[model samples]
Target: MAPGSMGTVFIGDPTAKLPDDLLVEVISRVPYKSTCCCKCVSTRWRDLISHPDHRDKLPRSTLAGFFHATSATEHHRHLSHGYLSVSGNWCRHDAALSFLPKYESLEILDCCNGLLLCRGRKSTDPKTLDYVVCNPATEKWVTVPATKWSWDMSSACLGFDPAVSSHFYVFELVPALAWNPIKRDDYSIEAVGIYSSKVGVWTHPIVLDDPIEILYLSGGAFLSGVLYLCSDNNSVAAIDLEGNCRIIPLPTPHDDPGGPNVYVSRGQLYLTIQGASELSFWVLEDSSSENCWTLKLNISYLRLFGIDYSSSEQFYGVISAHPEHNMIFITKGFRLWY
Candidate 1:
């Protein structure tokens, strides 16, 4: 271990052409800020070290405010019941997976800024609601204004813009008088409440039925602004933040609907078609105006053995065509064979 002014540090031999495994091992040593700066050492190190999973693998040395993205499969337990199983560096290092205290369930997931919004995750702070957001990497944190969920999700979001700092607000929920608790009445937010991270406060509130479909759904996707499933009287559409509603035409392939559904990979959409004798996958190409999906690859071995394509989201960035050997190994994505 090499000692440094900032903190105790370890340096891997920069000259040694370490294999992939050893390289990742060297990167696993430093804490966050130093790790960020150490990225300047070399290109290969930067690539392996800069990965999100690597950053997340760092220890969460905070009381609260570190939200982790987990696959839906993980049940009520908060310690990432199932997730990317990257451990034991290729050469010699400890496990790359993160192991933090199990109690911080209220941590919020902030992908862009790498800040986590959370309440208390430990048993010690269970009594009261504490508003917080933190960057687990640097072990830095901040306190927010509110941690109450008295109101419904309210088709809302935490957003920031040039005119206003960051804050939380409902997306499109309409406002109305609070329910007369004594009498019968409906309570709603006339406007969604926007929360600003930088400003560290929530705007007044805004409520909207934003997505006619969002009403039917359980939750919303936070990426690419937000994708809300909405249904009008006549049409069902996906509404983006810009108020642009794009209708996704449900495909009715002449073939069996029993076949595997379509999925996204490498930024393109693909459909997995099952067959009695051979399995075929079609790539949906949007290179031109005509929206057409063509059979791209076929694997003959699948005829002898059944195949199921697990997309990135499903398998923690690892693609699996078979279920039995779920954690067999990681390999460079296979080239599709048509």
Candidate 2:
């Protein structure tokens, strides 16, 4: 009405009476950062912003960047974040995770569905560790309760599925206790403890029947309702909600005997092995069989980046692999490259 309009008189606030579905649709189209900010506008906005229905309608959160550790001082270690682009390059930026408490050192235990499961130890006692789950996009985090079990030889991973449930879970892997050392292996019983966000507590540890040794470098990937873990013997172990366990051996043999990085991408499981000059990727074709592993891609540094594969330059470990985008994030020294 104020501008050049032909007999068009705008009524009261248009958004005031807008339908919740329409508002949610508009808000879902915006960036996640903007949607987070809108949560403070009103109670309705807050509810819609975080509601599972609204979040499900939004786009899937893909791999954006990662937080990399640089160096450690007397007290705290320095961390930097890097963003990945479609051009296969990572740009560094400063990320002050204010949600994280002050600690001597912090380790990224796992990253899944836009959340980071971090473990940190205080300066007074490095043996005692605290855990935190953080969503860097919204700067929202929650401290995980201290586990009832011992931290010695324990590892954990994050499990989340936006489709099946709004809540996520944490799976902690620990070794079984031994009354007598001479009779049985140290890792004869694999204990799996789950922490659910909805219940806000850690459930009783689920003990597996088999005594499978978990590999130190074996990362976990959750698909469907089961979590897949790589064992020290280059075999994959799958555990479901019902406490059933199955061991699937890898078809392609490896000489190093080192566990490759395991991850889930686009409803499929993948494994990546880094060699001196090339990186090999294997994908699980038949989920039902759980034995077929096809070598999907082998990328050589010389061919991909025009860098000498046999160069004496320092190379960093593979940080993450984006299956949907066909990119892998690697760190070399202090810099991250894709």
Candidate 3:
């Protein structure tokens, strides 16, 4: 075999090409980074590597661990963040994001699929910050341009599904004015700033005709080009890529003490509510049209952790659900469990 022009390797004859099966077998054994580099060798190579039939034989990314922030303590006034590997194989990964550009501070805002959205303060100007989206697997990143009213934004979330499209979006929710007496304390969303990676620019903040009230700006789930957020008025606010918004009422009353957690598991939207002693899981069905949540599972804390619930002491809180499995991660006191 000899190296030919345009990244082609010829065997015996200059025009002879390798078989696709053999290429797949060879590429599957190499590291994921090298496999990605192989895609740029030629158009034929790229097509073969990206083909649906060859996906199973290709080197792909997997969920290895989680990035989390610890609560601020008296000794440590600032929050500290770290990564926890699920399989106790953490040495191979660099969770510190050392590949990104130097910054005064970097805070992880959200993560979807294998991408992370972070806020990095400029080293020279600590008061100025930029939103950066990066893939730790490939060490590729892009900085999002700031919106005109970024200072008024309350919270932000990432919306990306590589299986759906190569592009990604960032949603920044702008809260209603504080002096608005009618919407006070409701946490109503007055406007939304949407940034599209495909266009490489942010659309002017879209002002909502009717403000949507949300409990908090913490948890959100993005699926099928739509973002699902927990609503304060016993419902969920579903916003699509076009900025259209709708409200889906919960199947049961929103009486959970800590509010319901919304997430995507196994390509489905799910909600988990923690009660006094039991945890109830709900799945959103027929989400394309009329949305309805169906109860999937309900289990008591005693059965899950063998611990009786106490009214004065909170036991566990659901952190997240497995994206590809039916497992749930929970935090109890200072320990994490699944």
Candidate 4:
């Protein structure tokens, strides 16, 4: 068989031909699309592939895509529809993110697994925000009701785990209130509100035992059930499901004016720092250990795009890293490439 191709499967007597174990190996090696097609192959294949254990054993899809800035004119606020390629190429799908209704302004807060956490606010009620979790590929979306602290939240994230449960959780981190005992100038996020899809209600705000002062908070990434928030102060806040918070310092301070991009890929935490000429990657070896960061990869601008690092005309940003692949998506101007 050709490389990366789904090898053919010959089904016959279970005892003499293809056993259940060998059938699983064949299905697991095929691409996700092929695996989906197997449902129609035979009742045995369908049942074998759809079984809970068999489904969990299958490998995850390697390709993941993200939509960058929109190309809408002043009258419209639609994001341009396209995806970045693994080879750093841009492909336009000629689609817009009109999935959410009646929201003139929409922003992508974060993406977890295959779902996107989007923040939307209509022009009429600018103060109120609406959060939605959706799969762009399946065009399936669910709107999360606003929690009491949603209006005061500094950042939000989507927590999802297909293995554990079908329902996902939406978390909002609210900064310290003015009337609290902590000084107003402290500027720390002391409260968190979590909305559980399983229960369809937002829980009361959970106060942290030790609140960390944060200058600015980027969106969060959920890794191994813990939500990690990157801040502008060269630190990260790790919050567990129980609302316990731990402050973790970065290995090196960010040189770029904008904060570094942090994400979780394949259960490992990664932080990317953009330099003048090269992009430095640091992997969190052990979240609990000191000096946990280890330098992983550095890509130079000259080699990445064949452009001079000193050039003043072009600007680039790392979009995201693939879950299991060693590829990352980046954008230059309006074009996105993996």
Rank by TM-score, descending? 3, 4, 2, 1
Off by over 4 Å in 1: 1-113, 121-127, 147-192, 209-338
Mind giving the per-residue lDDT tens digits that candidate 4 earns over 108-213?
7667787778888877888777898887767788888876666655567789877678888888777776226455643577777788888998877788876656
State residue 108's C-alpha deviation in candidate 1, in Å.
5.2
* Candidate numbers sorted by lDDT from highest down: 3, 4, 2, 1
- In terms of lDDT, the poorest run of 10 residues in model 1 is 88-97
Off by over 4 Å in 3: 1-61, 71-79, 88-91, 178-186, 288-291
- Which one wins on TM-score? 3
**Model 3: per-residue lDDT, tens digit, 1-338?**
45664765555533127788887888899976677788887777778787878876876646668877677789975556778876322224467788889887777888998789888778798667889999886789999966655554566889999898999999987777532535655367877778999998887777777787776634889999999888877778888877888888877775555777799988899998777778899999875455578899999888887886654375477878888767888878778899
TM-score of each: 0.37, 0.66, 0.76, 0.68
lDDT by residue (tens digit), candidate 1, 1-338 = 45656765558765466776666666567654466566677776677665655645543222211123443344556534222223212211112123333354554422223334444444666554444554445555555554344232333333222223343322333224332234221223233444555455555543344323222212232333433232322222334444444544323232321233333334344445434334456555542333455667665433322333332221111122221111212122332121
User: Which candidate's lDDT is highest?
Assistant: 3
Candidate 2: how many backbone clashes?
A: 0
Worst 10 residues of 4 by lDDT: 86-95
**Model 1 C-alpha RMSD to native:** 13.9
Single out the weakest 10-residue window by summed lDDT for candidate 3.
86-95
For candidate 2, write residues 137-222 as lDDT tens digits.
77778888768563543567888877688677888776665323454455544677788888898878777777667766567888
